[model samples]
Target: MILANVTLSGCTGANSALCAGAGEGHLGGGSYRTSLTPTGNLIVAVCLGFIGTFGLTNNLLVLMLFCRYKMLRSPINLLLINISISDLLVCVLGTPFSFAASTQGRWLIGERGCMWYGFANSLFGIVSLISLAVLSYERYSTMMAPTEADSSNYYKVYLGIALSWVYSLVWTLPPLFGWSHYGPEGPGTTCSVDWTTRTANNISYIICLFVFCLVVPFLVIVFCYGKLLCAIRQVREINASVSRKREQHVLLMVMVMVICYLFCWLPYGIMALLATFGPPELVTPEASIIPSVLAKTSTVINPVIYVFMNKQFYSCFHALMCCETPRRGSSLKSSSKAIRAVTGPRRSNDFLFMVASLGQPAATVPQLGPSFEPTIDITKGPSSDINNPVVVSLVAHYDG
Candidate 1:
């Protein structure tokens, strides 16, 4: 009879709860079964699968590049490495469970599983945000005050990474400490923070997360980057030769990364805030699903951005993957030629002449001076010249 119902539900595009609750229906209310539908489960599976696969592959590529290339192992790249590691965790551990819950439309993994999933997801997300803030500050210091930027020591980088982990723990630890609970919601049966059941606790937690993770970090990044841009502009005005094109490229890259970050996570933040403070009727299943998907989307987009927008990262990744050696001789010659080409024929004459001279081999010539060996007695204080024979040795003898 249950098999018949499962088949019928599949045919009607019914919720996944039909299959998900087959064995675990004893734990929750029978009403939970209504949330399961075949169509919804399929959607969850497809979305999560796509996100998990792409995010994992991209982050893995980045990790390989960082490990293989010594040049890419800067302090800034370290932060990126940390971010990729966290994102990869989400892709491998968090997203698969989420997909399963969505398809099942019931808490098949149960209460324990829900808490673990939530903690992992929240931990990685928070870490990624903190890393972004660290990267912004690092760039600002390097560009605005090069001397002050000398503080980017090994200990300092380790400290920043430690702080990121601490921040993640602060947000993730609350639910486990009895401040919140997780459960199934909507027609998808996916588990999340039980905002509807424990409104105040959920509100408090989400507000804290927003303040620490989003609001404060966003402010820090914007302020630092803004000051950096202004400082660069000032230098450019003082001397036209002080062109900061490299710094500008980095700033643009950071801006694009932050903008993408905002797009991916903002909707989730808005939804969380609304669920907490807005009218209860606004927390519809359909509405909640939008943010859930957006949050997952954020994890997937970061790897793509890192791979495509970061030139150094892309080059390093290509070298690692393709096993291609960097061309030294050709690159140097080409670069010199380019400079000459840009500086016109007059400048090219001197530079090309230099290049030609460097291509010739060196030859050793014989010495042109006569040589004579010299001898000295222990008691002698001076010696005569061999060529002139005018000078005579002077000796002092002492009686013992």
Candidate 2:
């Protein structure tokens, strides 16, 4: 709880006034010194403000979408809501304080405030990471067992959600109990795990945190998605009904999510490790700021990639805002019936549910006119499942 008012070594000129005793770069209670100028502080403030505003807005909209649409309440999607809540909490409890401190060019809140900021952000962020891992595994398991009646049972989903939070708590609580510490981080405007403290107490915690929190979750995501892709490829070979374009779309979505997760978090993780294990001066205060900013940017990028890109959600969102009722179609029911008729009751259910998981049936799934009758397309050739009405319909539904 020691507050340092150490002066910067190279500060001069008008910037010197801002750097004057206890004026700037002075974390209220920490050993670290910030080398940021007033201009740097202003830039940090602007970034935090932008992230806070958009993150709050987007996450709230996602919450609203979940509440307004019954279809969105599927067991798997509940995990998405869990992620949004954590991101929203970061926007609410973490971002604003950092924004205010950045504007003032120092940590405004006292030692207790710094502790809370560090602990809360760590808790919420880890929860999001664990939840994403669980989400990927859930998607994989659900797809693999699509034939199971309770493949996506709420009990299992809720158990996963609870475990994610509990696991995050196990990692985050140690700092408070003195396994490590939370103190002013980059430029003295934010706070996090005491990366600069090279003591065994701090170093042990950082190593464990990196392994359990970052590396494990990332590996889980990669493995589950890899298997999911392989399974989809297998299904495509066995059933020509599956759309290649839709498979590509699913692959793109998976890649975007994984890439975004890595892009946002990897630098911050590497920086922390460097600060912990490398030479004392290896990571500059100015250099540390970028990774912190990138980590927070995840709060903004998540909703766009995870929820907004979903076609069913996109159409419903448009309908909700534009005051146009979403188009009605019995295609989903008929499609299911046709699939059941062809594959029989037991096997067809899995295919239908797999399609739903791949992507929900959009409003654009074609409706059959009363005069129309199901017919095999001879021109589609022997290899094409286009001859099967069920397969033809499935492709159209997926193309949405």
Candidate 3:
């Protein structure tokens, strides 16, 4: 709800001038303060402009790649696509408003616009976070139980995606209904869940939002990736053929996952907590805006880490960029040939090892051959005849 505009009392000079627009009420009972100079706001506007442009373009490319390639439409990738969709929505619905606001040095949109921005961003951000956690769990589970990981279980992934959106919506809706509120945040140019509000209504929501949406998802990603690393270690122990370089590569990937999760979210979470509970003025507008800026970086970072890093997706992206439409069939044939080369006589056992090492499939592994039995014993280890059909086809569904 739009609050009544009170005459500026405490703010002086530029803050007073910037807040002096017609019909502009200090969102959340006139709590917002602008410390950023006009030039500072312009810099922020430029940053957000770049973020929005790159974020929109990159995510759109991901969606386009998914749409253009039937091979890319695996169950695991569906979760990745869900993340891209959320990030894309953020770019479209959330970033533009903030960009425009920064250009003006204050929020141009009113209180309702603030609420919508806060709700939409929170909802989409939570969806992206939850989807990452779910994707990690899916990867871990698929690796653990190769037999059960098949195309028939696509419904489970769809269910996970639906549940992520529902879960995010549950958290984001409370603010709209007054469990908390949305209002102008740092520099008065952006709006978010009312972080500066020091009331039971707002603090409780911030705590819950921090713990569940940010902390919990981060923990899940860590736990899942840690388990994946442990599994890779076990494979290394069972088979000496696994090189230390491969182990290092797996470790690096895990580090990247953890680092990316932290890079995108930890600062934002810290700032929110500080704003909610820290001493007065501890989270200055300038300091608070840094985290908010860092948070926006996730929209660009997520797709690069989660989707573009995949081998199959990269190949399709390369084809798309080069306009190799006619060569698409030959490329698939080459992919098949490459799969056979990797799965060939001398190093068949290495196939499963490679999957475990890389934490994903190198290429789309084909389904079980007609002549091959579906059953394979994991007890025999990576060197088992399991590589014949079971492991190969099982890991096929492990696409990102």
Give per-residue CA lDDT, model 3, range 1-400, as digits (tens). 1111225564455335434542245435422334578888888999999999999999999999989888777788889899999999999999998898888666766767877888899899999999999988887766555343455468989999999999999999988788988776767777788776677887888899999999899889889778766655654564445434445755787798789889878988888887778875577766677788788889999999887766567778877888865233322221111111022223233233232222223333334555333222222122112232112222222222
Q: Name the candidate that leads on TM-score.
A: 3
Which lDDT tens digits does candidate 2 get at residues 1-400?
Answer: 1112235674465224434533432443532234478888888889999999999999999999778876566676688889899999999999998888888766667667888999999999999999989988776665444232242358988999999999999999999998988877756778888887667887888899999999999999999878766655544655545446445756897899889999999999999988878876577777888999899998899888867775445655777899865433311111111221112223222222222112223332345554333231111111112222222312211221
What's the true lDDT of residue 389 in model 2? 24
Q: What would the per-residue lDDT of candidate 1 be over residues 1-400, giving only the tens digit for each residue?
A: 0111123334222334343553344345332342434676677678778988888888888887767666666566677788899999988878887676666655456546655776777788889888878867765655433122332356667778889999888877887776765445444344455555435776677678778888888888888667655644543453334234534654686688679877877877777677667765566655566567677776678767754455566555555567886332211111001101111122222221111111112211122233311111111001111121111111122222
RMSD of each: 18.5, 9.0, 8.4
How much does candidate 1 score in TM-score?
0.69
Point out the higher-scoring one by lDDT: 1 or 3.
Answer: 3
TM-score for predicted model 3 compared with the true structure: 0.78
True-structure lDDT of candidate 1 = 0.56
